[model samples]
Target: MVSSVNNPAIAMAEKPPSLEKEPMADVEVGIAVTDEKDDRPGEGFGEVSDLKRGLKQRHIQMIALAGTIGTGLFLSSGKAIARGGPVGTVIAYTVVGLLVSTIVFAIAELSALVPLSGGIIRPAEYFFDPALGFAQGWNTTYATAMLLPSEMVACAVIIRYWTEQVNNAVWITILGFLLLVSNMFFVGVYGELEFICAILKILLVVGSVIMGIVVDLGGGPKGHRLGFQYWKNPGPFVQYLGISGSWGQFLGFWRVMGSAVYSFSNVENISVAAAETENPRRNIPKAAKRVFVRVLLFYITSMFVVSLVVASNDPGLSKSAGDASASPFVLAASSSGIHVVPSIINAVVLTSAWSAGNSAMLGGSRVLYGLAREGHAPKIFTRTSRFGIPYVAVLSIGLFMVLGYMTLEDSASTVFDWFQDLVSAATYVHWIIIAIVYLRFYYGCKKQNISRDELPWKSPFQPYATWVALVSFTILLLTGGYTVFLHGEWDAETFVSNYFNIPLIFALYFGYKVFRKTKMVSLEEMPIRRFIEIYQDNPEPPEEPKKGWRKLNILW
Candidate 1:
């Protein structure tokens, strides 16, 4: 189970030993991750639970919102509209939503049962194909590589609203620094900050939806209810899924899908956080059950309302090509004849970007630590601050923030665009792995004689749903690139962008296998129970590190 802000929760199953309660003065410098093998935090990335479960309901509230909101919806929504038109896009979203929900439910059930820090990806090694785990873990990390910049660029762009007088790159630099600094402090602070920003993100999206609804309902300027005027006026669906959708349009949805993919990059955060929650068995199940509700009520509901209020035919819809300027949410607010609302929305959306960047940094860092703990990465990444924060991983992951800012360079948009496309395309590859993993999970349950009653939460439509998800996801990705072909504006960029996903997936799998000579850990060799037993030995957490400037001594 891993959460990422500085590094989203990267919780793995393991045990604890008594923490060193050194004086506060001695603990401030930072903790150096040693090769200690007593099954503590650094016992080869054993697990993370250094802090208290002080997060309130609001924290969970924002985490879910932050997970779903941000650059994806605000910026990517318009692209979906342009491609799918009103009808096709609407249908696509609904379909994707349901399938994703099903996967989430399955993830929830397994996570509640396993409660591992590595989340679904780690468990893939156990429940599903071990090869599936390698794929998921590696791709998840690489996806973050692409996604981190996507978010930071959006954040930089959003900041432009406050002061257009300033050059965009300046904003990128500032925003990048802001997020990097946050990560340096540690996961707890990162979590708290993300908690606040996530809440704001939700409020902004939810509030905007309510506003658009009220205005559309004849509550705004001149009693002119916007209603679904555009929907009907344009004839239900403006674009057709076939010839009506066009190549350019349909490919556009892939971009939006990329953003949506990012929103859920760490969807299994609760599983990671479970290892750190005050009470694992109790808190985890509750969070798992609630995750579905949060997704529907927040993400789908907000997107649905916004799509309704603003007709897909609107010119603003066309411009959104998913660039910050193209965000339909901001444009629609502007169109409503509400001036301040647009700026306010922009400000909040800025939070979404910054918050997302925060999540990226947090998640990526833990990934580094996880890999290091597994002996897949360098030992340096295992070092932690005196406060139990993984310092090296934090800094290593933060390096990407600087590179993320480079994408903001105007001259680099093409390169950035390609990078973005490549990143988004990774989604199809990822979901495929997830599907594969789930498929394996089903058989693993049966082969291992694990019963439904033993499951903490059981996904409905199993076996069947797993097949449906895998098949549909494959079709969507296969057809996705065809949209570009249909547009007749096809080029290397289009083809490579759309097709590279498959190769990238293999590259990671084979590349790592060759280097590590890694083989799939099969059912008999799976270490799930071994990991759980280790943590069971020492239950009491180490005392909090003392707070001081020079006294920082990180326990690596």
Candidate 2:
């Protein structure tokens, strides 16, 4: 049933003639898209679908980078350091970082092949069950929608460090408008804004680390040589729930996993823009790889530096003050008598929150659009403007941005905490589903005789790595609210915040299953071969040439 395209490169629905012994050094992929009828069924976008290919390679790289560096790093790390202490916090983030890298690699490999608009959402349907795809698509959309409010609220809180005179709603309204404008204009605008925001975040992280070093070396104005003093005095571990000895220390490390996971929540967002990026087959894998390395470096190095500069027992580390002064970087600088650093850090966090909110809009709206296209949501949600913006979807999610004004009636810190717990557990569920999706794809590849070498990006030790991350994330999800279960330590809000998402995901999964009468896809029936064929049909443009010392750019 394959087309008789003599070029071989443009053949659709054919099995690869043979697995290459070694990876193809540079396969010439055409820009030619497949004929509309031959594209996957039940996935409704066609050749004329107006979602513009406006995101360039740098856009995606910055999108992925901006996705990871958010309020979680700038603000929440202080709380995590307080709970887990310096050493425990560092170890916890490192473990979660590695696990995130695994997930990123797995997604990168699949995204290189599929390169669809919805990213992992379509893969779930293709590889497993359509019902799961429906559930995942909506869950991701909801999580992302909720994140918009979360980041907006974070911005409001950050602004308080400078002036509490302005109403929280005013700040939320302004930031929300900014997010809406950035997304509604063009995908390229979103990319450009994120690129600039990501650079700012990068500067903040590097500057903070350098400043931490200077303070530690007694080179700063305070003349305090901190070195490992905090680690030694606080002794590197905080006993959780008053549990003594090794068990308590273990719990301390385990506790920070939630924060670590939250910080990396949207790293997978790189692939969500696949449909809008040119040459997704090449660019997505590249972006995915860079996201992992850059996010890891920013997160791990910042955590290490924070550990050195701020004592875990510092009251400031545990302070729930709704401002950037509570951020560990600001605290570290303040301790070394650097008065101006707090406002500087505050400005960076404000942009970080804005950037995070922008990503939420892009990710959430696209997921909703994908759901509509797949017939999981209302068809009207799929409507796009002449410029390719999903106007309806964007507006639909923008309505939820008003949730940021919740901080007006409640304490900003309290509202932020509530959103944090919800997003943290939801993110764990997302990761678990990603692991399952990858495993199913891996098995289908094996069953269909698709060699790893034929993939756009090959991840080593595949099935095993996926399994480990799957189990670990599942464990984390179930235990995310362990403190709530501790004797005499229970709070209804905490318990609900941490564990509610577990049942909600289950409800969505089963609710969709029953509603759709869906069944799991058999390995033989999965369309791995069709996707590979589709990938072969479209050749990517040659990579843009790098000029001068720009050729030395490794972060991108």
Top-scoring candidate (lDDT)? 2
Q: Tell me the whole-model lDDT of each prediction, alpha carbons only.
A: 0.57, 0.78
lDDT of 2 at 417: 66
User: Which lDDT tens digits does candidate 1 get at residues 1-556?
Assistant: 1121111111221222224532111011011222234433312222443433333344544564456666556766775666555555555566676666666666666655554344556556555433445565666677666667666766665665566577766777777778777877645677689777776776777787788788778776656777667666664444434444455455445445544554454555555444444434334445545656666776677666766777776777655233445667666666766667766766777787677677766666665555554444576876767666667876766666556645544543335445545655666666666677766666655665656655545777787876887897787667655645654556788678768778767776677666545455444333344333333432324335567763563110
- For model 1, the run of ten residues with the poorest summed lDDT: 23-32
Question: Model 2 TM-score?
Answer: 0.91
Off by over 4 Å in 1: 1-46, 49-58, 127-132, 240-265, 272-274, 320-325, 408-420, 514-518, 523-556
Q: After superposition, how far is residue 17 of candidate 2 from its true place, in Å?
A: 14
Q: Give the root-mean-square deviation of each candidate in angstroms.
A: 8.9, 6.1
